[model samples]
Target: METPPKTDIAAALNRVLLTRKERLRSKNHWAGLAKIPTTTVLDAFKGSNSTIDTLTKLAEGAGMTLAELLAHGDPDWEVQVKIRNTFRSWTIEDVDGLIRLLERRSGPRDSDAS
Candidate 1:
């Protein structure tokens, strides 16, 4: 799948779960995933203080589609994934949503860690 543009990442997620509460309650949710919530992940983006491997693990655990998390939850689910390509140092293939998130967060342009 071709990777969607980066901008739509967050928007797709908004359309998806509506709130952190719902994402938490998802069928795929697991204790490993819940250990860190979306808000926590979002906040970590602010300072590049988070780890990518951790995020990917969470994403997989939560059953979040990869394309959804990678584009920051962009509208397009298609992924032209240059699998294992790290952006802004956010690449951790083994992990779940963690790598892509960290990549965006570490960058100066996407430091919206709120």
Candidate 2:
């Protein structure tokens, strides 16, 4: 799956930080908790000079897992989330049946059979 755009990621992180009851006091607080440099966090918010790993650390400090952060960060996250959730409660048999059904529908039709 495609990573969220940097701007969206920055916005999501800011939203999380701003909305939490236990608000971050400063960039230094976030940097310490996230175990990254303050400049990294600052640069991330500005959508520059931040690696995925650095951003993930900040997300964790903001009380979000990487996936949760991405869910908030990416506008297109819902589709991928829905697709993943679709199989979450399925049994092995259900998956097999789904695969078989898909294969049948997607395979060559009788009219095309040689």
Instruction: Identify the candidate with maximal TM-score.
Output: 2
Any residue pairs clashing in model 2, and if so which? Answer: none
lDDT of 1 by residue, 23-50 (tens): 5554234333647665655544343444
Candidate 1 global lDDT: 0.48
| Tens-digit lDDT string for candidate 2 (1-114) | 996465476766676566553756667788888988888888888867567798788878876667766665566655654665586679999989988999898986678658
Candidate 1 TM-score over all chains jointly = 0.33
Where is the poorest 10-residue window by lDDT in model 2?
A: 76-85
Query: Model 1 — which ten-residue stretch has the worst lDDT?
Result: 76-85
How many backbone collisions does model 1 have? Answer: 22
Candidate 1: lDDT of 40? 58
Query: Each candidate's TM vs. the true structure?
Result: 0.33, 0.54
